[model samples]
Target chain A: MIQVEGLTKYYGALAAIRDLTFAIDRGEVIGFLGLNGAGKSTALRVLGCVLLPTSGRVTIDGFDVVRDPHEIRKRIGFLPDTPPLYTEMTVGAYLEFVARLRGVPSGRAKARTIEVEERTATRDVHDEVIGNLSHGFKQRIGIAQALVHNPKLLILDEPTSGLDPVQIVEMRQLIKGLKGEHTILLSSHILSEISQTCDRLLVIQGGEIVGQGSEQELATQMGSGGYLEIEIGGPSQGEGRAPVEKALQAVRAVAGVLSASVIREEAHVAQIKLDAPAALCPQVVRALVAADIDVMRVGRGSAQLESIFLKLTQTGGQPS
Target chain B: MSATFLIARRELGAYLRSMIGWVIIAGVLAVDGLLFNAFALGGGDKRSSEVLSLFFYFSSGTTMIASVLIAFRLLAEERQTGTINLLYSSPIRDGEIVLGKFLSALAFLAIVTLATGFMPMLVMIHGKVSYGHVAGGYFGLLLLGSATLAIGTFGSALTRSQVLAAILSACMVVAMLVAWLLGRITERPLSEVFSNLSLHGLHFQPFQAGIVHLRDVVYYLAVTYVALFAATRVLEARRWR
Candidate 1:
């Protein structure tokens, strides 16, 4: 649905984004992960057709962004970091205006507004003034505006930014609901926020694409593989580090285990960081069960993701 | 509807529903009426044409003032609130956006300018007057308003802050208003050029006196076209910026 090559944008002497290249396929939810001021917004702005790239080229749905922006615009919906809302307008009215602005027939714009309001779950506030809406509702309405015209591609920049925790989850669910309907390219500073929602990840740093793949592909590319944290308890898992290591011997002996370490230990419980593919969690748990060790709890190591993100952004995905 | 009208309708709705729009309208009406009563009516024993001319004269000032206030927000507020993104990413031409915004502001300014029509009818109550004079004066006000609003739109396009937009618009309009003064001081062809460029002295006077000269009509229109064209170019240049 999108192709970008050597996309560079400069504000006078300073380059906002430089030599950024990536592609997104139809029906794929792509996450643009980067730290703040890492040029993610600039890259997305180029794709959104809001800003002309200083150099290079971007095409959406087979139309070049520079030469055929109006054609490309008809095929895309964009939500900037801050929702572009006329606060004085009601949700329904705002959506209708956007629908018509995006080239929906005037007769159909109202019905299409209703359709997007329902899809984004903003139907209840259809008549409510947007200025009176909560942050969560405003964000939902923002999504509704983007979806009002039913564009093939949705470019959402920080769609979940500034929302509360619950609102964040709801916004994520809203974006996830849109997965198959439109090819979504969303950006966020947090790794785990979009890690699950995105079918593929493009890690950008310093205005360049430093990494691109699925989450596991990136983890694997980072050379640490996937991390699974296992909590083991029971009398056999003794107090000392030595006993805990001994108790996890069978888990280490699993076919795909690369390394294992007891990260934390208490009287009868231990947290083990296992270096292996997360898909091997079942076999690792089975090995523990066969060894008669209590498998107290298991969770994917999110800390490793933070470290991976840090490494990717800080070292430009060099892993050192 | 076409994108131009679509944008214009929404913008006009905003003006009707928002405080700034009404505030400017009310303010212009109050100022225009005060100037009408105090100067045009207060001056001793003037002819009906003079009274009507005085009405258009003061109305022109208020119209230009209202245009600056009305047009300053056209593009600047969109950028300030980030709503320009919606327009920028839409499948619409920059000229359409500029034209739509200008039309909305013009429509609203017309409403404000025309609301003062009762003042002219007051002239008809106790005085002898030709309806053509009233009509011509109003035509001149609309043309002046259109040209000033177009200039203000260009000013708004140059900046994101409405205050900066107003300042810039006021500066440009003042420069054009004083072009006749500059004409008085310069010599020969340069002076003639300045006089011709005078937004008020050379062009608007003919309409103020009940004569719709083609030269004046064409001049106001040319200014409107040039200013609106400049505003459109500014919008087009923003993406590259």
Candidate 2:
């Protein structure tokens, strides 16, 4: 549904986004992942038809952004990082206005508004003035406006920004529900949220795309073969460390194990980090049990998306 | 055109709903009334034509000032509050956005200007004032208001700060208003050009004196058109920025 090539935007001498090339297929939800100032908003704005790229080309649904912006605008609904809301208007009125603005017929605008409000779960606040709504409701109103005209693509800059945990979860569910109807490209600095929601992610840093793929693909690309973290209870006394060491060695010998290391050792338990394909986890666990190491707990490690994001952005760089 | 009217309707609705719009209307009307009573009516007995001319003179000043105040928020406030993205991302043309905003402010300013009609009617009651004079004076006021609002819309498009928009527009209007003085200092053909180009000097004097000149009407409309076109260009340029 979208294709961008060499999309560079410069605010004077500073380049906001440089050489950004990507394509999004129809019905796919793509997450733009970057830290603050990583040029995520600039890229999204270009794709949204809100800003023109300094150089390069963008097309949405076969229409050029620079040459056919009006056509593209009619097909795409963009929600900027800050929701473009008229606070003085009621939620229903605001949605209706947006619906018509995006080319929905006036006769159908109210019906479209109600449909979007229902989809975004903003039906109860239909008559409430937008200024009086809570932030969560306000964000929902933003989503409602975007969907009111039922465009082919939805570009949301940061849909979960500034929401509490519950609101974030609700928003995630809301976006997840929107998957099949429209092509969605949402940007966020929140790793877990993007991971949980998007089919694929574009990791950006310093105005450049550093990585792009599904979560497991990125993890494999980052050289960690999708790891397993295991916590085992074993003798940690003077001579007791020997059994734990033997268990670790035995687990390392499992068929798909690339490497293994003891993460930390406690008096009665030891946490081990294993570098291996996730499918080999069961074999590693069986090996540990056969060696008389008591397996306390086992799960996928934190080094999945987080480590890949950190590696791509580097540790100290802030998200743009 | 439908997009233009849709935006205009929403903007006019905003003006009607907001306290600032009412404040501007009340303030301009009160000031117009005070000037009419203290100066036009109270300076001593005079011919009704002179009184009506003085009323137009004072009302023109209020109209110009009020136009700046009304239009300063048209685009600048949208940019300030970030609501401009709705217009920018929509399928509407940039010219439509500028025209819609200018028309809404023009409509509001017209209402405020019309509210001061009682002052003219007062002159009509006590003395003899021609209906043509009243109509001519109001037509001039509307034209002057339209021109200034367009200039202010251009200024609003140039910045996100409403204060800066007001200042920029006021500066443009003041420069045009003072062109006649500039003409007075310069010599011959240049002086004629500057005086003729002055926004209120020769152009509005005919309307103030109860005569509607075609050239004056065309000049105001031209100014309105040029300013609105510039505002549209500025809106288009913002996408590049």
Fnat, model 2, is 0.83
Model 1 / residue B107 / CA error / Å: 0.6
Backbone clashes counted, model 2: 6
Q: Which regions in candidate 2 have their CA more than 4 angstroms from the true location? A: A229-256, A262-272, A282-302, A315-320
Leading candidate by lDDT: 2
Candidate 2 chain B: minimum summed lDDT over ten consecutive residues — where?
Answer: B36-45
Write down the TM-score of every candidate: 0.92, 0.93
The residue-level lDDT of candidate 2 at A26 comes to 100
For candidate 2, write residues A107-201 as lDDT tens digits: 99999988888899899999999999999999999988888889899999999999999999999999999999999999999999999999999
Q: How do the residues B43-103 of candidate 1 rate in per-residue lDDT, one tens digit apiece?
A: 6899988999999988888889899999999999999999999899899999999999999
TM-score of chain B of each: 0.98, 0.98
**Candidate 1 chain B superposition, TM-score:** 0.98
Error of 1 at A18 (Å): 1.0
lDDT of 1 at A190: 76
Native contacts matched by each model: 0.95, 0.83
